[model samples]
Each structure stands twice: as structure tokens, then as C-alpha cells.
Target: MDFTYSEEQQMLADSLRRFIDTEYTFEARRKSARQGESLDRGVWNKLAEMGVLGLTVPADFGGFGEGAASQLVVQRELGRGLVLEPVTPSGVMAAAVLSAHGSDAQKQEWLPAIASGERIVTLAYLEPTTRYRPESARASAERSGDGYVISGTKSVVWHGAAADAYLLTARVSGSNEIALFLVPRDSKGLGVTAYPTIDGLRAADLSLQNVAVPASALVGQPADGLAALGVGLEHGIAALCAEGAGAMEKLIQITGEYLGTRQQFGKPLASFQALQHRMADMLVQKELALSMAYVAAQALDETDPAARRRMLSAAKVTVARAGRFVGQQAVQLHGGMGMTDELSVGDYFKRLTMLDQLLGDSDYHLQRFGEVMEA
Candidate 1:
């Protein structure tokens, strides 16, 4: 596959890097985290101004229509900066779903707001009882006049508290039909409990007790809800793979710099052959993960669902393995300072760890990849 990024994509990468250097420095990130703030609305607005939020939105909704490679670039930069914004679950995946499945009126009403950063949206697809089953919606939706009464809780909703609305998943009553509903955050009987996550970001436990929305809230065909959910999860896996690769890259750079500057036995650790070999291993792992990211990007929107799933699982497992190797080596190379909050090394490792569990982990995807290949 050709790896040609448009000149504009490169410019976007450069621009994001500049912003990171000027605004998302270690001090700023640490201050926000220490202050118990899960997200910086200021940075969120800045990203919107930079057009990062609109990259995946459709052109008719005042967006750039950027996808795959462009999103990979943007997400990688977000990883490098340890950005706390929910751009993946909220921006990329959400925009992809809405653009592909939302009605024209729905698109017109919400997409523009999302594009302008006037509203934040997130996907609520998980339930406490379901494990990676996009279609296994235990939450029941009772049919009301034309719409449905949503009653269920979505666990571990990423940045749910900050969202203006959610694309909620539930099983329609008296049938096996699954559906995605667009529920506003201020809807009656809806509640959110926010908390910090292991990655120094935010997530919330969402409860929906008979939350009512109009029939127009339904996203895509009811039976095809699983298909839409699959697409969203695929984008999620791709994004997480790239983000893991980005964090791995930063970890390698930080480890190498630490080895060069930190003295060991009256000489720089960089001069030690043993440490040098470890750093080389880290670089190899990072590069391997990066190659998998591009491969995942290539297969992101493959028309065949089975083919896309196989390819994404393949890339996800590979990235998870490489990320673990890179993360562990990075922390080990830095010794005591590696896990401390004062150093960014620990935070990067934590983020990498969290990324592994997003969508699916190496063990989970490895089994799926093997099964798909055999099929």
C-alpha cells in the first residue's frame, strides 16, 4: 500500500506539533491532571479552531471529510502530547457514525454543532454485562408512541460527563432488534457519574432510566444498528492502534534521551552496550507498531465486513504486543523515575496500557485474528 500523506495532512501534523510544544507541555498536562480536571475545555476549543474536530465530519456539514490516514496523523499527535480530549470516541468514531448513518436532518442539526465545537458527542455502546459484543444490548428500549423509552446503564462511557449528547445502544423490546438512539445529555432520567481513568483521562458511568426521545433519534436501520456499531468500533481500534504507536514513539524518544543524559558508572548510559541494545529493541518495536497502524488504516473502510474485521484485529494484536514491549522497556530503562508522576515516562506507559484495553487487547484480538484467518 502506498503511504503517501497529502501535503495538507503533513501541514496538519506540523501544526499540531507546534500547538503541543506551545500549549500541551508537560507542565500544562501535569497541572491539569493534578488539579483533578479530566479535560481542558480550552484545549478542546483550540482543537476545534484547528479543525481537528471536523476532520472526519462530512463536507456538507462544514467539515473537511478527512479520514483514515489523516485521522491517524491527528490521533498520533494527540498521543504524543498526552492530550486528554476525547477526540477518538467523541470526534473520529462519533463523526464517522453520524456521517454514515445519520439522517440528513439529523446531520444538519447536530453535525454543524459538532464541527464547530459548540457541542460534544460520544458513543455509549458498552454495558456492564456485555464484553465486546456490539449487538448484545441488554439495555431494553420500550416502544412509546413513535420513539422508545430507554432504560439501562452504559458503563465506562469515555468522557461521558463532558458530552452534550450520546449515541446510545439498546435492544428494542419484544424482539431481537438492536438500535442506536441519539439522547441528549439533559434528557429526563439520565444521569452521569464522572471519574478519572487509569490513563489520566475521564470516563463516566451513565444511567438511563426511561429516558425518552423522539423516533427521529434512531440512527440507521434498527437491524443494521450492529453494522453501524461495528464500523464505529473498527474506527476505534484503528485510532487506538495509531495512538498506541504514537505513545510508543514518544516513550522510545524519552528513554533514549534519558539514557544519553543520565550517568551510570561515571559514564552516560548511552555509552553502555547493554542499554544501547535495549533502546534499539524499543525502536524496532515502535517501527513495527507504526507499520501495523498504516496497515490498519488501509483496511479501515474495506467494504467487506469480515475482511475489515480480520485486518483490524490483526493490526490491533500486533500493535498491542509492540506497545507492551516498548512501554515496559521504556519504564525499565528509566529505573525509579520511570513510574513517578514527575516524569512523563510513567504517564506514557499508562496511556499505552489503557490503549491496549480500548476496543480489545492483544490476547483478545490474537484469538479473533486466528479465527478469522482460518475462516
Candidate 2:
């Protein structure tokens, strides 16, 4: 299959890169990190104006409806810039879930707001016990009069600090079936503890202690919650792989430039044959990762769930492993300064490290891939 970017995709990539280069500098990112700010309103609005926030949503809902391929383009640029926004969670994943399963009224209400970047909604499915398995969520929702009361704890909700609401998962009371609910952030009995992550982003731990919602809050059939969550998870993994590949690619470029300029023993580090070989290896890993990202993106269009999941697992494994290798090499090539806050290399490495742990890690994906093969 051809993985080349279309003209529109290339245009989007170029546009986002230009914006990041001029507006989203490393120093600006550091300032936001120091301030403990997760979402930069100015930047978020600009992204919306650029149509990036709407790239994945259905066109009928005022989005570009560009799908996974466009998502790959947008994510790569965000990764290169080390952006702190919640595009993956709100713009890509949540948009996909809502588009797929939201009621007509829900779509009319949420999709336009999401595409316009007026609101943020992140998936809140990960629990202390779920361990990356949405199906294992034990949160329960009990019918309360004309509504339902939900009780659960969601950990490390990405960009939850800025979310106006959450697309949460819970088991319906008296049944084994999972259900999806739109939990507003202001709901009574809901608790949000926000914190900054090591990668300079923000997350929140959510506590829903009998938080009540109207029946309209339910998304799609109560029994199809896992399937709804799967749409978001799969898209999220693909976007993340693309982001990691971009980060790896940028890290390699930065390391190469550092080797070319930084002198040792009266000669540039790039002159060392050993260092050159290592750079070559980093390049190879980056290329492989980029290819794997494309593979995952392409797999998003696959109609067969098992086959699509297997391919996504494969891509995740390759990208996760490659990210680690490339990140570590970038830091090593930069020497002691690599870990220093004054250098962007450290930040890139940190982000890449967290990316491996996000969604599912290399080992997890490898095991899942094996399981799929066995099955």
C-alpha cells in the first residue's frame, strides 16, 4: 500500500510545521511548563483556526473529516513541536468516539464545539485496575429515577485538567455490560485532582462518587461501551505512533546537528566513525518507525476488528521500541548536557519515554501481538 502523503496532507503538515516553528518555540513551551499550564488558549485557538482541531471530526459536524491519514499529519507536527495541547485526546480520540456513537443531539451539541476548540472532552476509561484494558473497567452506573448515578475512579486522564467533560466507561448496574456516559466536569460528587506530568503535560485523577447524569448522557447502546471505547483507543494508538515517529525523527536531526557542531579533541564529534555508525543506526530506527506509523494509520480503515487490532499492535511495538532506542541515543550523543533542562534534547527524550508508557508499552503490544497470532 502506498503511504505517501497526499497534496492536502502535505499542505497541512507544512502549515502546522511553520506555525510551530514561529509560534511554539522551545522557550515558550518551557514557560508554560514552569507555569504548570496544560493548555495554551492562544495556541489552541490558533489551531482551531487552522482547522487542525477539526481535522478528524465528520464534515457534517463542521470538521474537515480527513480521518486517520490527516490525523497522522497533524500529530507528527505536534510531536515535532512537543506541543502540550490535548489534540490526541480531545480532537482525535474523543471526536472519533462521539462521531461513531453519539446520539444525533449529542453530535449536534458536542462535535461543533470540539471542532471549534471551544470545549475539550477526553476519554476517561483507564482505572487503577484496568491496566490498559478498557474491558476490565469496574466502574458502575446505577439507574436513578430518570437518570443514572455513576461511581468510579479514573487515573491519569490525559489533559483531563482542561476537559469540560469526559467520555467515561462504566458497567451498567445488574448487568455485565459496559456503558458509555458523558460526565460533565461540573457534576456534583465528582472530584478532579489535576497534576503535571514529567513530560510537561497535565493529567487528572477523576473520582465519580455517585455522580448523576441524565439519560441523554448515555452514548449509544449500553452494551456497546467497549466497542465505542475501542474506536477511540485504536485511533489514539495510531496518532501516538505517528507522534513518536515524528519525535524520533526530530531527535535524530537534533543529535546530528549537535555532533556536527560540538567539538571534542579538536575535532567535531561527527568526525568519529563510531558516532557516525550510531547515527546511521538511529536513522534506520527512525525510518522503520515512520513506516510502522503509516502501517497503523492505514490499519485504521480496516473493517475487520481483529485484523485491525493486530496491525495496530504491531505498529505500536515497533514505534515504542524505536522511540526508546532513538531517544536514548539522542541523549547519549548529546553527552552530559543531554539530560539538562537547558537543552531540548532532554525534553524530547522525556516525551518519548512517556509515549512508550502511554496507551500500551512495547512489551504490552508485543504480548498482545503474540496473543493475536496464537488466536
Candidate 3:
């Protein structure tokens, strides 16, 4: 399959890059990080005006009527900019989930606002002990008079505190089956505590004490909640791989420029043959990672389960390895300044570290890859 970006996609990327460079510098990111809040409303509105927030929403819902590839392009640019916006949660995860499983009424109610970036939504799937398995959720939604009462705690929900609504995953009463509920953030008995992550992104812990929602809130078949979650997970992994590839590219570029200008023993550090070889290695790893990311993005719609598993696992593993290598090498080449917050390289390192852990780490994907091969 052809992986070359279309002209429109390239133009979109260039526009986003230009805007981010001019308006969202590392200093701006640092200020936001220190503020310990969700993204600034003004910047988010600008993104909406740029049409990025609606890249994936269907046109009928006031979106651009794009697909996963378009979303991937936007995410890659966000990564390159070191942006702290909650694009993955709101754009990819929540939007994709709603598009795939929401009833017509549910779609009409939520999609327009979400597509316009007037509303932010987040996924509440992780439990205290669930680790990386969406199916391991123990949160229960019990049938009540005219609706369901949900009681559980969700850990590390991306943008949970600032979200207008939550896409909650819970088990149905008396069964291992799973379901998703669209619970408003201000619902009665819902408690939220949010903070900035080490990488400067917002995350929250949610406590639902018998929070209730009408049956219309449920997305997809109750028993097929796990399946819907799986689709979201796959898309998430693909987007992450693309983001990692972009990070790796930035790391390589920044390190190269630093070496070219920094002097060692009366000569530029880039004059060293050994360092050149290392940079070459970083480039190779980044290229391979990009290839895997593209393949995984295309494979997300594959009909065969085994093929999907294999491609996604491969993409994750490739990204993890390349991300680690690029981050470590960038730090090493930059000497002491690489670890300091004043430098963008250090922030890149932290962001890449968080990406390494999100969804699944390197070892996790490696094991999954082995399993696919064994089967």
C-alpha cells in the first residue's frame, strides 16, 4: 500500500507546524506545565479554528470527514511540536469510540460539540489494579429505576478533570460482560482529582459513588463493550506509534544541530566519525519505526484478528525501541544540558519516556509480538 502523504495532508502538517512554532514554543509549554492545569482554552479554540480538532469526526457532525490517516498526521505534528493538548483522548479515542458504537441519538447529542472542539471528552477505562487490560475492569453498572448506577474508581484518566464528559467502561451486574457509559463530568456523586504528569500533560483520578445515567448513555451492545474498547485501543496504539516516530525525528534533528555548532577540542562535535555513526543508527531506527507506524495505521481496519494483532504488536515494539534509543542518544550527545528542563531535548526525553509506558512498555509489546509469532 502507498504510504506517501497526500498534498492536502502535507499542507495541513505544514500549517500546524508553522502555527505551533510561532505560538506554542517550549517556553509556553513550560509555563503551562508550571500552571498545573489542563490546556489553555484559547489555544484549544485556535486548534478548532485550524480544523485539527475535527479531523476525524464525520462531516454530518460538523467535522472534516477524515479518517485514521488524517488523525495520525495531526498527532505526528502535535508530537513534533511537543504539544500538551489532549488530542489523543478527545480526537482519536473519544471520537472514534462514539463514531463506531454510539446510537443515532447518542451521536447527535455528542458528536457535534466534540467535533467542533466545544466539548472535551475523556476515556475512563483504567482501574487501580487493571494495569493495561481494559477487560479487567471491575467497575459495575447496576440497573436501577429507569437507568443504571455506576460506582467505581478510574485511575489516570487523561484530561478527566477538564473533560465535559467521560466514556466510562464498566461491567454489567451479574456478568463479566462490559459496557461503556457517557457520564457527564458534573454528574452527582462523581468525584475528580486531577494533576499534571511528569511530562506536563493532564491526568485525573475519578471516583464514582453511585453515579447514575440513563440507558441512552450506553454505547454499543453492553456485552460488546470489550470489543469497542479493543478498537479504541488499536487506534490509540497506532497514534502513539506515529507520535513516537515524530519524537524520534525531532530528537535526531536537535542532536545533529547541537553537535554541528558545539565545539570539542577546537572542532565541531559533528566532525567526530563515531558520533556520525551513532546519528546514522538513530536515523535507521527512526525510519524503521515510521515504517511500522504506517503499516499499523493501515492495518487497523484489517478483518483478520491475527493479522491485526501481529501488526499492532510489531508497531508498538518498533516504536518503543526506537523511542528509547533516540531519547537516550539525544541526551548523551547533548552532554549535561540534555537532562535540564530549560532545554527542549530534556522535555522530549520525558515525553518519550511517558510514551514508552503508555498503553504498554517495550517488554509488554515484545512479549505480545512473540505470542503472535508462536501462534
Candidate 4:
């Protein structure tokens, strides 16, 4: 039950941080943003080469054979660097979902490609009306002769436009049971509209009109999809919380440096008592959020499902609040220049705002926490 990161985990985090600092600087990130892609293929390949993409994939699948802690380290560094890569959406969430529930053949077919960064997959769970509710999917997969015909529209599919495939959630026709289906990007009757998001990331709206797939495409049993989704979502939320903690830490550092150098009223801003107190408060919030993130990461496979859910929800809520507070304060403290395109501070704020809405918002997760408590 020790909450501290192991030596190996710390090393991995440090290495990733150094790599990002050297290769994914603000200028390079801005350049990629201008080009309309969230990540550079070269950089992504480099990450794969470094074994980052394979951190959480099992060793039997040609991966690092690490666990949730290793993935958390990578996610934290990615957030600190303001990376726009689809690693989390594709590499973590989609990969985890498949690893958790996919059949042996499915694992052998996809996990290696994903681990090697040769294929990208994204979860297409959100619908226009379903909002963040995975269970509310209106998409249907009807049984055909020896396969299934899927018809539905998925909105806000992260990196869906560029993904090699999709891990889709759809309702079965007769049983009303939800199921996960692996649909290739080039499959017939699949349409996609890709665009940039506020956080300088790529997303797409997916239209599946009778997209047919073999019965083997189904992940696990149809009745197990919802439960499997919950597991995947837990991992996703924990990853976001870790990312939010890193971003909050970066915000604090940036603001501290700015206050030390920027003078106001003929003195350095950091010399002011009020600003110092505010920064202290920000640090407190960051520490609490960080602690929660670590707890949630370690609680990933806890015996008590309720404990796991509570820890994950608590971490997410804490991180969301900290992200919003730190982001807004960083911008406000930076004054007029903070909101301009020329400043990294502005980009950080935008990214944090977007993270607040991802997985589930603070309010949404808070209610979930309550539900878990009652249960």
C-alpha cells in the first residue's frame, strides 16, 4: 500500500520528461499546432522506439510488461510537455479496453501493432445525445447471417480521423445489451469528419451506416460490454488525473518564474505578500491532487471495486478542480500577454480547460462518487 513511486517508475518519468523537454518544446508544439496535427509522426515513432508506447502492454504481446504505474508516468510527462499526441486516447484507452476484454486471436492480431505504434486505435463511445454516458449509446449492431451490421453516429471521437481502427460501443438489437466491436478504419460504410479541437488535438465525428464486421470482432460477451467499459473508463479517468496533476505542477512553476522576473509597482511580483500567498494556496491544491492521483493509480486493481471507484472519482475531481484553478490563475497572473497566441501560458490554459471536460467533468464524477458511496 505504499503510495511512493518505485525507483524504476521514477526513472521512466525522468527520462520521459527529459525527452519531451528536448524534442517537444513549445516552439515545436506550436509548429505542429499550426500544421493541424496534434502530434508529429517522427516524435511518436521515437516514443515507440523508446518503449513508451509499450509501457502498459503485456510482455507476451511484445511490450514492456509494465503496469498502470508505468503508464501513469508516461501520461504525467506528456501532460507536462503539453503534448497533443493521441497516445492516451489510442495507446492507453483503446489498448487497455482491448487487452482487458479482447479474445486471444484479437490480442495477437492488434496488440503488437499497437505496441509498436504501427496502428492507432480510438474508442468511439460518445454519441451526440449520450454525452458522456457510455450506457446511453443509441448505436445499434444487428445480427446478420454470420456477422453484424452497425449503424450509428459517434461524436467527439478522439483521434478517430487518423486512427487505424475503432473500438466501438454499440447496443445489440434484441437483448439491448451493449457490445464492443473492433471496426477497421477502411471498412465499408464508415465515414469520418476530422477537425481540430480547442486543445490543438485531432478528433472526428464517425458515421457508421451498415458497417459490417465478422462476429469475431465483438469484444467479450455482449452482456459484458458495459462492465468492461467501466473498467476501461476507470483507467482513462486515472490517466487524466495524472495528466492534470502534471499540468498543474507546470503551471505553478511557470507562474513562479514569471513572478520572480516580472516587476510591478517598482518591485518584483514575487516580493508581494498577496501573490506569495496565492502561489502557496496553488501549491497546496497541487499537492493534494498529486496525492490523489498516486492513490488512484495504485488502486487500479484493488480487491474492492467500491474502493477503486471511490479513489478514481476522488482523484479525478481533485485534479479537475486543481487544473481549472491553476490554469485560470496562471493566465490572470500573466496579465494581457497570457491570452495571446504567442504565450505558452495561453495554450496551457486551453489544454487544462479541455482536460476538465474529458472522461467525465468534475460534476459528473462527483455524482459518480456519491453513487459509489451509497452502493
Candidate 5:
């Protein structure tokens, strides 16, 4: 199979790359990060104008992409800049959930806002007890007259504090089935504690006590919601894989540059045969991760759910391992300066570390991959 990007895909990638280069300078990013919002609305709006925020939204709702291919391309670009925006969560994850499970009216209302970057939406799936899967969720939604009352806390909601709305995951009353609801951020009995993540992005701890929503807030069927959640996660992992690839590439670039500039023992560090071997290994890992990212993106369109999960798990494992190796080598090569926050090398290292923890780590997915193979 040909691995080259289509003209449209290449165009989208080039457009995004140029935007990152010209607008997302390290200093600008450093400033925004210091202010506590890893993402600026102005930047997000520009991304929206570029049609990147709606890459996965259904065309009926004003989105354009070929499966997950285009998204992978955009994600790679965003990753290169260590972008703070919650693009994958809001645009890819939320959009995937809405398109796959929402009512037509719901779609009409939310998709346009998201596409235009007029509103931000985030998915709150993991509870403190939740481990990538919602199996440990203690969050519950009890049925009421024409409505449901949500009562539980969600931990580490991606961009939750800044989002206009949250797609909450709850266990339906008296059943093991999963239920999803769209809760407005200003809803009564809702609270949030926003904090900076290790990677400079913001995440929130959400508190919900008797927060109520109309039955119309329900997304898809209770039984089917869990399945849809899986699909959303698969899309998220694909985006993460691509982003991880881009970050890995950047780490390789930065390390290579650092070695060239930093002199050691009366000669350039790049001249050391040992370090040269290390840099070569970093490049190989990055390329391997990129190839797996490509596979994960394409696998999203697979007809069989089992097959899709297997591929995503495998790719996640590959990306995680490669990411860890690249991050460590990058930091080690840079020495003490690499660990300092002032430099981008350490920041990239932090992002890579967090990426491993998010959406399940390498060991978690490796086990999942084994489970799939067993079945």
C-alpha cells in the first residue's frame, strides 16, 4: 500500500505546519503556558478557521476528513509545537461521540459551534477509580421525572474548566449500562477545580451533586453508549499516537541540534561516536512510532470492532515505548539544562511522559492487546 499523503492531506499538513511555525513560537507558547492557559482562544480560533477543529465532524455538521487520516496529519503538526489546545478532546473526541450517538437536533446545535470554535466541549469519562475504562466508575445517574440527577466526581477532565459543556459518563440507575449526558458548565450543583498538568495544559476535577438534565440530554441508547465510548477512545488514542509521533520527531530534532551546538572535551558533542549512535536510535524509534501512528489512523475505519481495538492497542504500545525512549535520551543528552523548565527540551520530555500516562500506559494497552489476541 502507498504511504504517501494525498494532495488534500498534504495541503492540510502544510497549512498547519506553516501556522505552527509562524504563530506558535517557543516564547509565545512559553508565555501562554506561564499564564496558566496552555491554549489561547485566539490560537484555537485560528485553528478553527483553518478547518482543523472540525476535521472529524461529519460533513452534515460541517466537517471534512477521510476517516482518521487527515486528523493524524493535523495532530502531527500540533504535536510538533507541543500545542496546549485540547483539539483532540473537543474536536476529535467530542465530535466523534456527537456524530456517532447524538440526536439530529443535538448535532445541529453543537457541531456548528464546535466547527466555528465558538464553543468548547470536553468529555468527562474517567473517575478517580477509572483506569482508562469506565469499569470502575462510581458516578451514577438516577432517573427522575423527565430528567436524571448526576451525582459523582470526575477527575482530570481534559479542558473541563474551560469547556462550555461536558459530556459526562454515568452508570444508569439499576443497570450496568453506561449513560451519557451533556451538562452545561453553569448547571446548578456543579463545581470545578482547575489545575495545570505536568505538560502545561489545564485539566479539571469536577464535582457534581444532584446536577440534573432533561431526558433529551441523553446520548444514544444507554446500552449503546458504552460502545460509542469505546469508539471515541479509539479515535483519541489514534490522535495521541499521531501527536506522540510528532513530539518524538521534535525531541529527535532538538537532541540532534543540542549535540551539534554543545561542545564536549574540546570538540562538538555531535562528533562523539557514542552520542551519534544514540541519536540514530532516537530517529529509528521516532520513525517506528510514526509508522504505527499511521496504522492506528487507518485502523479506525476497520469494519470489525475487535480488529480495530487490537490495532489501536498495538499502536499505543509502540508509541508509548518509543516515546519513553526518545524522551529519556533527549533529556540525558541535554544533561542538567534539559530538566529545566526554561528550555523546550524538558517541556517536551514532560509532555511525552504525560502522553504515556494518558489514555492508558504502555503496559495497560499491551495487556489489552493480549486480550484481543486471545479472543
Candidate 6:
């Protein structure tokens, strides 16, 4: 099979790459993070104008409705820049959930705005106590006179401070059935405490004390919540894999340049055979990760749920391990300066570390891959 990107995919990647290299420099990114800004509406609108924010939304909703492989192309570019925008959460994850399960009116209202970047949405599901197991959620929703009252605390909601709304997950009161709802950011009894992640991105802790929404806010039947959640997560992991690949690629370049320039014992560090071998190993890991990212992206279209799950799990495990190795080696090769905040290498390493834990770490997905193979 041909591995080259299609013309459209290559164009999209090139457009995004140019923007990152010219506009969103490392200093600009650090400035935004220092100010505690989660979503830069100006930058987001620019991305929207580029049609990137709508890459996954259906054509009926003013989007290109591109598939996972196309999404991987876009995300890899974002990763190279260490972009702080919540593109994956709002663009990929929320769009996937809405397109898959939202009602006609709901789609009509949200999709267009999301496509235009007029509004931002993200998934809020993980609880403080849930670890990474979304299925073990304790948040609850109760019927209340043609509406539902939801109460829960969601931890580390991606770009939560900037979201105009959230797709929240809650268990039906007194039942095992989990459900999804669209909660407005300004809804009464809802509180958001924003903070910067170690990776220089923003996240929030959400407090929902008896927040109420109309029955129309329900995304799908209670029984469908977990499946929908699973769909969202699978899309998220694919994006992360692609992003990790881009970040690793850039990190390797930075290390390579540093070694060629930084003198050691009256010669360049690149002259050392030991470090050359380490760089060679880093390249191998990066190639392996890029291949697995393609595997995960292609697997998104698999018709069989079991087959899809297995491929996604396998890709996640492989990419996560590759990311860990590439990140650690990149830092070590850069020496002590690599760990300092002044350099971008340390920031890339931090992002790579967080990516592993975001949608289940290497250990978790390795076990899942084994379970699926046995099944």
C-alpha cells in the first residue's frame, strides 16, 4: 500500500505547518501560557478560517467531514508547534460525539458554531476519583420535571475554561446507566476553576451542584453513553498518537542541531559515537511511532468494533512506549540545559509525558491489547 499523503492531506499539513512556523513561535506560546489563557479566540478563529476546526464535522454541518487519517495530518502539525489550543478536545472529540449521536436540532445548533469557531465545546467526564476509568464514574443525573439535574465534579477538563459548553457524562440516579448531556458554561450552579497543566496547556476542575438542563440536552439514550464515550476516546487517542509523532520528530531535530553546534572537548558533541547511536535509536523509535499512528488512524474506519478496538489498543501501546523512549532520550542527549524551561525541548518532553497518561498509559493499553487478542 502507498504511504504517501494525498494531495489534499499534504496541502492541509503544509498550510498548518507554515502557520506554526511563521505565526505561533515558541515565545508567543510561552506568553499565552504565562497569562493563564486557555483558548486564544483570535488564533482559534484563524484556524477556523483555515477550515481545520471543521475537519471532522460532517459536510451537512459545514465541514469537510474528513476521516481520521486526515485528522492525523492536522494534529501532527499542531504537535510540532506544541500548540496550546484545545483542537483535539473541541474539534475532534466533541465533533465526533455530536456527529455520531446528536439530535437534528442539536446538530443544527452546535455543529455550525463549532465549525465556525464561534463556540467551543469539550468532553467533561473524568472524575477526580475515577483515575482514568471513565466507566467507573460516580457523577449522577436525576429526572426533574421534563429536565435532568446533574451533579458532579470533573477533573482536568481540557480547555474547560474556554469552552462555551461541555458534553458531560453522568450515571442515571439509582441506575447503572450512564448518560451524556450538553451543559452550558454559564449554567447556574456550575463552577470552573482553571489552571495551567505542567505541559503549558490549560485545564479546569468543574463543579456541578444540581445543574439543570432541559430534556433536549440529553445526547442519546442512557444505554448509549458508554459506547459514545468509547467512540470519543478512540478518536482522541488517534489524535494524540499523531501529535506525539510530530512532537518526537521536532524533538529529534532540535537534539540533532544542538549536538552539531555544542562543542565538547574542542569538538562537536555529534563526534561522539555513543551519542550518535542514541540519535540513531531515537530515529528508529520515531519511525515506529509514525507507522503505528497511521495504523491507529486507519483503524478508526474499521467496521468491526472488536477489530477496531484491538488495533487502537495496539497502536496506543506502541506509540506510548515510543513516545516515552524518544522523550527521555531526547532530554538526556540535550544534557542539563534540556530540563530547563528556557529551552523548548523540556516542554516537548512534558507534553509527551502527559500524552501517555491522557487516554490510558502504556501499561493500561498493553493489558487491554492482550485482553482483546484473547477475546
Q: Write the per-residue lDDT of candidate 2 for residues 1-375, one digit (tens) a residue.
A: 455789988988999999999999989998998799979999999999999999988899999888777788889889998999899999999999999999999999999999999999999999998888888888999999989999989999999979999999999999998999998899999999999888999999999999999999999989989889889999999999999998988888899999999999999999999999999999999999989999999999999887898999999988888988999999899989997887899899889889988888877888888888898
Ten residues in a row with the worst lDDT in model 1? 30-39
TM-score of 1: 0.97
lDDT of 6 by residue, 1-375 (tens): 244789988998999999999998889888998898857888899899998899999999999988887898999999999999989998899999999999898899999899999989999998989877788888899999999999989998988999999999999887898898889999999999998888889889999999999999999887788888788899999999999999999999999999999999999999999999999999999999999999889888888988888888888888888888999998899889987888899989999888888878878888888888889
Cα lDDT, all candidates: 0.85, 0.92, 0.86, 0.86, 0.88, 0.90
How many residue pairs clash in each candidate at the backbone level?
0, 0, 0, 0, 0, 0
What is the alpha-carbon lDDT for the whole of candidate 2?
0.92
How high is each candidate's TM-score?
0.97, 0.98, 0.97, 0.97, 0.97, 0.97
Question: Which rank order by lDDT, best down to worst?
Answer: 2, 6, 5, 4, 3, 1
TM-score of 2: 0.98
User: How accurate locally is residue 282 in candidate 2, as Cα lDDT from 0 to 100?
Assistant: 95
User: Which runs of model 4 end up more than 4 angstroms from their true locations?
Assistant: none
Model 3 worst lDDT window (10 residues): 356-365
Residue 2 miss distance in model 3 (angstroms): 2.7
**What is the Cα-based lDDT of residue 147 in candidate 3?**
86
Residue pair clashes in candidate 2: none
Candidate 4 per-residue lDDT, tens place, 1-375, comes to 554679988887888888888878889998888799876789889888878877788889978877777777878888898888788876788778878898999999998898898998888899999978899999999999999999999999988877999989999999879998999999999999999989888889999999999999998998888877777788788788788888888888998999999999899999999899989988998898888888778778787988888888888888888888888888888889887887788888888888878888888889989999888
lDDT of 1 by residue, 127-212 (tens): 88887676777988899998889999998888888899998899999989889888999999999998888878888899889999
In order, what is each prediction's RMSD in angstroms? 1.2, 1.0, 1.3, 1.3, 1.3, 1.3
Candidate 5 lDDT, 1-375, residue by residue in tens: 345789988988898888888988888988887799867989999999999888888788887744687888889989998999889888988888888889888899999888888888888888887777776678999999999999999998988888999988899899998888888899999999999988888999999999999988888877776776777788999999999999999878888888999998899999999999999999999999999999899788888988998999999989988998999999999999987876799888888889888888888898989998999
lDDT of 5: 0.88
Q: What is the Cα-based lDDT of residue 297 in candidate 1?
A: 90
